[model samples]
Target: MALGGGTFTTMNKILPGTYINFVSAPRASAALSDRGIAAMPAEFDWGPEGAVFAVESGEFEKRSLELFGYPYTHEKLKGLRDLFRNIRKGYFYRLNTGGEPAKNDFATALHPGTRGNSLRIVIEAAEASTEETPVYDVSTWMDDTRIDLQTVKTAAQLHDNAFVRFQAEATLAATAGANLTGGTDGTAGDAAYQTFLDQIEPYTFHALGCLSDKPAVKALFTAFTKRMRDESGVKFQTVLHRYGQADYEGVISVENGLTGAADDTSAVWWTTGAQAGCAVNKSLTNRVYDGEFEIDTQYTQAQLEEGIQSGGFLLHRVGDETRVLTDINTFVSATEERSSDFGSNQTIRVLDQIGNDIAALFNTKYNGQVPNDAAGRVSLWNDIVRHHQQLQTLRAIQTFEPENVTVEAGDTKKAVVVTDRVTPVNAMEQLYMVCVVA
Candidate 1:
């Protein structure tokens, strides 16, 4: 070989060839992540079993029948409709799974639920068929509506559709209609709810709704939320009905419920979506309740004040419409580590945005790729500064100083430590003014 032509940390190379070290100039690697995602565990009459499924707001109306076995206007989707009123996307887990699927001689229902009982398969001879080789027209119907139509010489040529799967091995025969039967809905119990929580752990949602009236179930959800937020570093709030005792920043206690609903926990659906969809700089205070349910907003002024004092997220009547009285979480007991500011949902949103975004930036750009050196630390600091500056511009936070952020190598050579300080901003919820004499 002629000489060494690679990077060097010292001038110990004895070769005469040029030893160069090329490095790109540091640039900001921080970008804020989007919100408007929520998670909910629901008991449905029909849906996918034992799995978490995503439903986007844009596709909810069009794909409702295929996904939930009901049209968008059906009464079964009222809770989902309320949820989608605010959130852009939802990770939904059906608590009632493991039920029996409806089946007939021709085909089987795609999912397990009572909705499959409405399905029927009709077979008739196609007009193009002859006596020697007859082609059959197979049509799958849900009630009176025809969902799928196929023409095949044998059952083996048939393909499955959204509603059901054809029995490829079964012989084809012309029948008026073969109705599917024996479909049953699974029971939603504590174990099923626990399974839903387990399945939803890996998902990233801004809010989670616990639509259970049982105190034990609410406690379970609250504990999960706390563990995820404190230990796992996943930041999200869980909305629970009448769960103000949680007293944690990661839980929002819905004080008011629906007026005429069997499940009084219905309000949690709307609150969860609203919380998830609220922008980092925005507040849900005074946001009109545009959901489907008629919320119980009959609270006295003293009660409303008490609700806020007890860290309850309440809704009250404002003129002709119901509106959010205060955007706060169940964070009543304040410690030196966490001040009263943590009670405000707006403040929590800002803090969560910073934590999640900075963690993402470090994990994606710097974790194992950047060396643990002074220059590398400075680069991280620059990115953090830029991120905070963006937050300041958005009015989510204020009083951010670049000098306050410090990144340094840890005791281990491979470890790096970061110290970040930020002041989150809250909305102006109270007005106190004095009239002066003219």
Candidate 2:
């Protein structure tokens, strides 16, 4: 954490974790009828410090304390979990022209997702012949006889000292942009739908500090915790994760076919009719009562066993070969152990992480198997979110259909409806927005 003092220190005690807003303090004004809102148009921002209520009278703040389940503790973790701490939360950006990390600048000039620097020097010698760039491993000026700029790292990387470097004062130019007036996304596929789609973020939201209206840290902390408990409890990301297993064309005995067809009389040719080498794969003996049911991806054998007893059958929703194999193995064990009717492939990876839990409950659907690239992942997840909106995520926020949703007057409340899919990782797939009481 960057202390107010000039020196930066490492905070060891802080183990990253997910959190939400929780309220304890009462409202000074009669703005919120239930949640202690100030009843007027206001900015209620939450962070590590506490609750920040921005009303006409003035901005108010509050503090929060959470009950964590971590078994071990130490001094290093001290003040680590402090609310609203800045971090490199899966995000990177180039600082402003004069900005430097070592120099200590918070607001950055470069936007996120800028590809790494790797450009050849096309220098044209001009002015004095003594011109040169910073000496790294080597220093060779761009040869044109007309100009002299030693090829150096990209300007974004060259924090300081450069007469002619990555960003040439005359050559390099940054695209000018104004504040985004509307939503972050310019095009509209399914803003409502995309939000419900789980977007498993890093344990870095606290670190990758946001430029929100919380004003101060204390207000942010109190509000964040209050919302965590008060918002909603049916935690999970809902998704109709589609699957197309390898085309199967194998035949078993008539008895196994369930038809008890005459072909079962002998060891007939088990032909997997496939024109293409699709590798028709199956669970060897996989079947789930020929239907569907929800199962958390993070559950263990005991949990699966308990869930199966409820009758419908349980399985994990998988998108890769590993999941398929694990689910099959677990199912086989359960079936053989109890002669049960449980099926394989029932668990789901809500966050696209190792488990199934929705941490960011703003999106409407749960999308997984996205590209490793940041931009691609965001796009693919958006599509999944649209799918969730179509499937009863939030009736108030539809894609093509405009269904007006209403909240009580003077209610400056923001509702983040999460996906109720199998096992949610967190509010990964969710939609977020402020509700102006109308």
Candidate 3:
């Protein structure tokens, strides 16, 4: 728990899921929430990298014993405990099954959606005999608030009217902002100011999940700055974004002893294909609507646990695209950055082309913002009704035509018309949204 000094400590004792146990700098317990880690001495041994190094030797006893619970666990845990010595044997089998080379099979994609988290952990196995075949079970505990960033009905000012566009970028930014106290680089203890700047890493989930297997995903995402060597070395990079999703939030990186870009061929391929399904809430590929990175290893022996169970997601799907008109009249005049309001038949540059679809499901809270024309009213009204049915829906059109919206000099506060037509195209502009789940 860090305050202004360089000192850090963990809550010395606790059981699983105990809220009070955590580690940080002096008075740094609050930082745990943003980082999504519980550093209770019961589950973790806290200190700087080398600070804990001496404990392994006889030089200093560890301040405490701490273990991390990765929202999931292996099945037959109780039964497996009896054979705890067998974990090493089972792990070797898993090692041989590392699949393909990370560079080949691994995949990574930066999603534009902002509702998600990150995850990573070591997966030591339970002891088992070849006859019984020990299994690894997993469970999940997702935050109910993961889906709380609802369709905003009304906000006096907006950076952009097009909400769906750049969602992934914005989400990443928020995660970064939340995880910081101030700076980015540090050793054990810098000045009081330096320590504060260094601890803000976990809460900013700017970078999404490692999203791939040990052999590949970690190679792509760990924090390192690039460096040059006479022997031909690449630059080192530092971990940039923060993550705090589910119980598995912290610096997402590769596990030790695991080859990142291994010389092996299969390991590379496995990294790009299907990651060990290790993501926390949903598949990195957007396969399920609302998913949980839940593992039910406790029931591994049941044989019926193949199906993964998860909570709901605000899945986005493409809607009908035939109704799209290349021509659209800008309706609202915006003073905010990144958005535009075109007046009448003027054309707007379509910059928002990235999305799962082409139509919009709008919020009725914006009903007042629609233009007064007939067509504008219709589009606005229809979108509102559709959004009420499903809060987070898919949208076909994301980027609006960028145009210069000019209203008569005195119409500053008034809702100026952007369409070229004198009559309204649809009046319910504020009521509708473009991105809703189908």
- lDDT value, residue 115 of candidate 2: 12
Question: Taking the tens digit of each residue's C-alpha lDDT, what string does model 3 give over 193-276?
Answer: 122223322221111222223333233233221111112122111111111111111122211111243321221111111121
The runs of at least 3 residues in candidate 1 whose Cα sits more than 4 Å from the true structure, single-residue gaps closed, are: 1-26
TM-score of 3: 0.16
Q: Total backbone clashes of model 2?
A: 88
Better of 1 and 2 by TM-score: 1
Instruction: Name every residue pair that clashes in candidate 1.
Output: none
lDDT of 1 by residue, 71-176 (tens): 8898888889989999999999889866999999989999888899999999999999999999999999987789999999999999999999889899999999
lDDT accuracy of residue 291 in candidate 2:
14
Q: Name the top lDDT candidate.
A: 1
lDDT of 2 by residue, 178-259 (tens): 1111111112122212121122121111111121122243233223323432363221111111111111101011111113
Q: Using Cα atoms with residue i matched to residue i, what is each candidate's TM-score against the true structure? A: 0.92, 0.17, 0.16
Whole-model alpha-carbon lDDT for candidate 1: 0.90
